[model samples]
Target: MHRVLLWIKQDLRLDDHPALQAALDADRLLPVYVFDPELLQPGPLGCRRLGVHRARLLLESLAALDGELRQRGSALLVLQGSAERLIPSLAERLDMDEVLTLDEVAPEERAQLDAVRQRLGDIRLLLAPGNFLLRDDELPCPVDQLPTAFGPFRQLVEQRLPVFQPRPAPARLPALPDNAGAYFASLPSLSQLGLGEPLSVANSAFPFSGGEPAAQARLRDYLWLSQGVRQHQQTRNGMIGSEYSSKLSPWLASGCLSPRRVLAELRRHEAQYGRNDSTQALWQELLWRDFFRWTLLRHGGALFRAGGLKATARAPRQLDRRFQRWCQGRTGVPLVDANMRELAITGFMSNRGRQVVASYLVGELQQDWRHGAAWFEEHLLDYDPASNWGNWAYLAGIASDPRQRRLFNVLRQARQYDPDAAYVSLWLPELHGVPQHLRHTPFLLPHLQLDALGYPRLESIPENWRPYLPSAA
Candidate 1:
């Protein structure tokens, strides 16, 4: 090929970029990132589809990407418009022989790709795999035949599939065509994008900035330097601090770090410092991530349905006003409130916290699971379409091991995971300086004391649970 256009998406980094490598198979390359406003539009029932936190992270990642490309005598063209029109039009204007990009699995993503392809008519467009640890074509069987259970999928992939070595970034790139720089649209600022300046949450667990250097640095600290990976299984459930977990999800979701590279590095870490159950547990998470990718591929639009894989199943509970309390973290559940408030303020949350709140929404509040999923899609910093929606469906008992225990005992979870009440206190300031056990059930406090404590009592308590109040204890 003589010339090509590299359509960068979630895989924003230069290193280990398969699409970029294939584009460089030609003599000239033009890299472009389009800010499709469609992504930011409201989703079902007026739920926000994209939140400011994810948007800010994307901007930072892109700025870093463009800087790296510039150092290599190339640049990332920033455009704000419909990608379906922009990509095909730009390819024709630049006279590129081919357009290259990652093949997305989700329907919305595929729709965009299809639109661009339809517009390209007769132009060569190539799709490559950049995000998953094992690409779709590399799977042992086709997507349709993928195992329904995560355990089966993980076992089969681990035993049979090979995670190929990631392609290294090209040392140099052919510069843009003459005067092609003139086509560069000015990059939008945070304010222009409707996001406020990034600020520190009072006590966030994931505080890292966006970009490749940050991602690599974090990986090194978490796995190699600090050996956090060794203790991952033991501490990943903790809800308070950054070091409790790897904190790599934000970077992984944004594609600053390649999934294949993460898996490869894990293997290298095990090689250097003998393998253990903890490292295996970490590897299992990577498999789960890949499994969700396959889930999206196999099910396509079905995953978005209320019943998910079980389309014939009964409709999920509606998002009632009581569910509104769950969304605001004020459903008289200390643990749920803390986690929800943390997510609202910091744009992050612990995995254990996620499972707990998700279960609460579905099992206790009887809210439709899709509404909660949409909220996560809007607010989570590390939100990936497959993982966010798939997990939500799983928790709501709509997919992925629905027979498993569906409801979370939020009080039990609070005492078990955060006995000190330290995590709760940080997010729910009304309970700050309160006793550890007292924070868990403030509603049980006497009305006068509840007022003194500055916490609101939940009026919608179930009748049978009244005697189990804090005062009785």
Candidate 2:
């Protein structure tokens, strides 16, 4: 009987998984997931790059996957090592004929795949596309010819082409080889992996469990029961709660849920509940997600660079003391500080919070944009390298847009999104007494009044609050 190995990375779900299906097509399959030590090491953010919450969620998800596989007379082999070393060694030991995996587009990820390919020279490496809606080569424009703006790109794709429907889940998986479980130890715990305890559910916006089933249920509830999807466009900028957005990014990033699954379910919801402008707006956001994935695939390492693929000049900035304050959420900017503190405590932040804090870091403090991006990489449960880097580049005016340095007006933003100061109050109790209009500008309050109000008093504004001024690092 032919032996095939299914290497699980980000694509963890059993439903609509092309790699898993391909492995089952063989006579006997060995399913494996390697916890790479490299990834667990501290990134530039000085934190365990994958925080405790996500690590715990991954363990739970893998356990669920293992349980499901066992019921089918198969098992998920959990290993901890560099995949480049583990996969080839396991293939040789098991005498597997081929390896099946989902395609990866990120430069670092592609390098890992290439290393595996080189090591397992004779073993067939079947790469099934799971990460993107459109294949890299299938775009209407050449990689170089793709539009720099999102509007034109979306318009072109929506009008000229159709997004492929997601594949159905395979009816059943093939049984594993008799000795598949012998090669690995038990899955590691959060503490074992050097990560802290799982986050307290009471404090988290994304309190739901991880796994395909949980993800699907959340989607259903959000779209149908809660009807949050109906007002997604309007309320998505919410700061204090979970209902503001779909909260699917964590699942999507972890591969517990597929984007296509979300799209299909969204279509079902629209059909049953009746379509509206809100649903279309939600759809637009999903398309944005797809666009970023496509951008990384086409641009390669340039997405990670300072100037991006187009090679624009980046504004030079110094990492100053104010940058440290921003990082620690002590900037005395209530809205910015609250958002940063929230992110520090919980691994998630609202889209509005993300933009505000990012802008404050790059624009207000004049810190290096990359530093903020790296911190988000470590802290965000939903951190996808492509989206995180792509967004930072955009905010820093280093990528895509000709209007570089897109900084938000903090006061204006506060009045518009958090007009009642409810979100600010939740995270910054000191700011609870601040009026709705002044909550975003606590520094503007007189020292005696600010002290009476219990808000931290800023000594003075940084000398470099000018628009488009490059921060000194």
Candidate 3:
């Protein structure tokens, strides 16, 4: 009988799993997951995104996956080490003939795959798609030819393209070796991984448990019980509450969910409840997600550079004291400060807050955009490398935007979105007593009032505060 190994990376779920199906096609399957040390190392922000909460959820998900596999007479093997070393070593030890895994576009992940291929001599590598509905090569335009503006990209893809349907989950898995259970041990705990205890639900946007089962339940509730899928575009930018958005980013980031599954369910909702503008809006956002993935696939290592995917000569700017103040949430801008504080504590921020904080960093403070991007990588539970880097480059005027230096009018945005000061009050308690009109710009209040509120005074605005305009010929 042929022995096969399935190397699980970000594609963590059983449903719609092409790699897992390929493994089962063999006579026997050895499912393994390696915890790479490189990923656990602290990023430039001095914090690992795999914090206590994510670690705990990962352990729980692994346990569930093992149990499900056991029901089918198989068990998952968990190993703690670098994938480059561990995966090939296991393949040799088990005498496996082939290795199957979902394809990844990120540079770092691709490097890991390359290392594995080099170590294992002439081993068959089966690549499958689970990340996006459209393949990278299948995009209508090449990376260089693609539009630099989001609107044009959205228009072209949404109007002309079609999304692929998701594959069904396997009814049963292949049996494992007789000694598989004895070799497999318990998953590492949060504390065991040198992280803190599980995060309390009070602070998280997604308080639900992790794993594919939980993801499917959320999809059901969001579509059926709440019927919020129909109104997603209308309420998605909300900051005060959880129900406003789908809150599927965490699941999506961890690979517990697939975008195809989400699209399929969304179509079902549209069919049953009748299509509307809101449904189209949600589809647009999902397309944005796909667009970012395609961007990374096309550009590869260029996404991490200062001038992302663009042929421009730009020098890295010197870091200013004002930039540090923004990072610490002491910019004296209540809306921006509150959003930054929320991200620091909860590791989650609304999309509106993300854009605002990113704009404040790159546009207002004139700081190195990479610093803010690194911070998001360390803190955000839903952090996708492509989206995070792509967004920062866009804000920094280095990536996609044809007209560089997109500056957000913080005050105008505050008046439009947080007019009632609800979101501001939730994060900045000092501004709780401030009136709705002045909540966005508390520095405008009188000196004695500001002193009474315990808010700090703002210094001179930076030179970059002016609206960005294209250079004249």
Better of 1 and 3 by lDDT: 1
Cα TM-score of candidate 1: 0.95
Please, what are the lDDT tens digits per residue for candidate 2 over residues 363-446?
Answer: 666677777887888778888877888788777774224455456767567767877777787788777676665666778777
For candidate 3, write residues 180-233 as lDDT tens digits. 556688887777777767446474566777777787888888888988877787
Model with the higher lDDT, candidate 1 or 2: 1
Please give the CA lDDT of all the candidate structures: 0.82, 0.77, 0.75
Local error of candidate 1 at residue 346 (angstroms): 1.0
lDDT digits (tens) for residues 216-259 of candidate 1: 89988878999999998888898888888888899999899988
Error of 3 at 471 (Å): 35
> Order of all candidates by lDDT, from best down to worst?
1, 2, 3
Number of the predicted model whose TM-score against the real structure is largest: 1
Task: Decide which is better by lDDT, 2 or 3.
Answer: 2
2 or 3, which is superior by TM-score?
A: 2
